[model samples]
Target: MKNVTFYLDFVSPYAYLAFHALPQALEGCSYRMEYRPIVLGAVFKANAVPSPAQQPAKRDWIRRHTTWLAEQAGLTSFAPAVNHPFSSIPLSRMALACSEDGAINRYVANAVFAHCWEAGGADPLDLQRLEALRAVLHKQWQPTIQSVDDEAIKQRLRANTDAALATGLFGVPSFVVDGELLWGLDALPMLRARLLG
Candidate 1:
């Protein structure tokens, strides 16, 4: 199977879009997705770039684009996040905490995105949100709350972000397949073709 490395941040609406789109795109392809959590802020800082939300027009555009894409993708359940560019630090840590040897890690990651992304401006790290995340993981896998604060998890996420930048990833929803970088949710078809042909 072709291996696809998914670089994701829960705060990214595009990443949320890819959460639903890529699976459909690669339905028949022989591929394995390896999900990793990275700090988008770290990526921006490493590149000395400002986040799109920092600009008024770009922020507005993202709002519209994500909403429209969600509808086109038949994901009407998705709404443009009202509070974008929210701090993803805690959510990233939760993803790292969810990491394991099997697919439940992906479940935990997606659950975090599902829980927080739709609310727009919702605080993902609030006590209530944290407990909700805990519930999601605990439902299937036993996750220690301390895992979020583990030094190994911290280093792991930091390394993931650095590795992503090394691969020329400048944004979320990036797929690195066989050393090829495909950026954005719109790049799903390219990834699908790579897996198919």
Candidate 2:
């Protein structure tokens, strides 16, 4: 079986878009999807890359295109939050913790993406919204919340971010298959083709 490791952060609109399209894109492939949560802000800082929303032209283009792509993918319409580049530290850490428990991580990752992108939450930093996601997952929120700042957990987030960078990934929604790197939701078709081939 092929393995596709997906490196993404909860705050990325592109990642949000990819989440909706990926399942269908890889439908016929015998691939395992490994959802890796990383701190986008940390990666941005390390690479000196600005968020798309920070650049006016790119921000406007992403907003328009994201909506169009979502509609095309039959997903609910999406508009990235104004203060996007939201702090993903807590959400990322929680995702890492969930990963330790097996398949729950995928469920939590999907829930977080839906919570932020579909539910129109301002940011994952919003305690109420985070709590709402926890309720949906039927997991205790405080333990996850409290674990975010733990040194070991923080280290894991850093390691994931560094691993992403090492994979030659410059952005979110990157998929890695047998050392092949595919970035962006637009790259999914290519990834599928490669896997199928």
Candidate 3:
């Protein structure tokens, strides 16, 4: 089985939809997925590109399209962040703090994703939301709320972003399989085909 590096940031609505859809999309495929959290803005800046949200038309399209995709995937509870382009650093750092290395497991990543994008969910940085996240993760990972502030966690996110940028990955929901990069929510089918082949 090959390793699929899934680069994600919670701020992207498409990433949220992709996160929920990925398991079924690749069902029975001989692949292992490693979840890597990165700062979306950092990737954009390093690539000298603008965020799709900066364009009015594209932003509207993304919002509409992702909403539809979520419904199609039966993720009825999906909701955009309370604030678009809000600080994902807190959420990213938290995930890294709980990670075994630079890679986060699906369970921890899912909790953070749901906390940031679930319908009626508070801001990911909200203390209550974090407390709720800590409660859930504590059962398995025993994540320390204090570790989010650790310098190492912060650097791990930076390093992950740097590594993704070096790979020419400029967006979230990107998958790197056998060193080949496939990007965007629409790329799932292509990814499945590639993996199956």
Candidate 4:
């Protein structure tokens, strides 16, 4: 069986959009989707990729386009939070920990995106919200959240981000298969085609 690795950051609205579309997109492929949580900030730094919000014109364009895309996809709305240079390290670390426990960790990922993008929560680093998310997951791994501050775990997160960047990934919601890189939720169709073929 073939497999595709999905690299995502919870801070990206595009990643949220991809999550909602991926199941349908990969329906006919004999491929397993592996989710890899990565640090978006680290990747941006390493690749010198600028955020849309940093450029006034691009920010406006993305806001309009993202909202329209979200509506077309039947999503509520698309408004990423106001945190300049979003901090998703804690959330990404938690996702890695969740993966270790044999769970998809979509619950936490969705919650983080929803809180930051849909709910317009300024602080994506809210510990209280993260705790609530953990409760909803029925996970007793209190140390997972705390592990974000651990040097070893932080190093792993950085390494993962570096690996992702090395793949020539310039954005979030990237899917890699057989060294081919597909970027954006819209590229899911192309990914599906490659996988099926």
**CA deviation > 4 Å runs, candidate 1:** 101-104, 139-147
Give the per-residue lDDT of model 1 (tens digit) for 1-197. 99889998888888988987776788989988888888898888888999998799999998888888888988766765566767787777766666653122567777888877655556666788788787777655435446667776677788888889999999998999999999988788888888787
Q: Where does candidate 2 stray beyond 4 Å? A: 101-104, 138-146
- Scored against the true structure, residue 81 in model 4 reaches a CA lDDT of 67
Candidate 4 regions with alpha-carbon error over 4 angstroms = 77-79, 101-104, 120-122, 138-146
Q: Which of candidates 1 and 3 is the stronger one according to lDDT?
A: 3
Best model per lDDT: 3
lDDT of 3 by residue, 50-102 (tens): 99887879877877887788888888888776466578888888778777578
Tens-digit lDDT string for candidate 4 (100-192): 432234566666567667765456666787776556544734444455466656666766677788999988899899999999988988998
TM-score of structure candidate 3: 0.92
Decide which is better by TM-score, 1 or 2.
Answer: 1
lDDT of model number 3: 0.84
- What TM-score against the true fold does each predicted structure earn? 0.90, 0.87, 0.92, 0.83
Ranking by TM-score: 3, 1, 2, 4
Candidate 4 has what TM-score?
Answer: 0.83
lDDT of each: 0.78, 0.75, 0.84, 0.72
Worst 10 residues of 4 by lDDT: 97-106
Task: Specify the highest-TM-score model's number.
Answer: 3
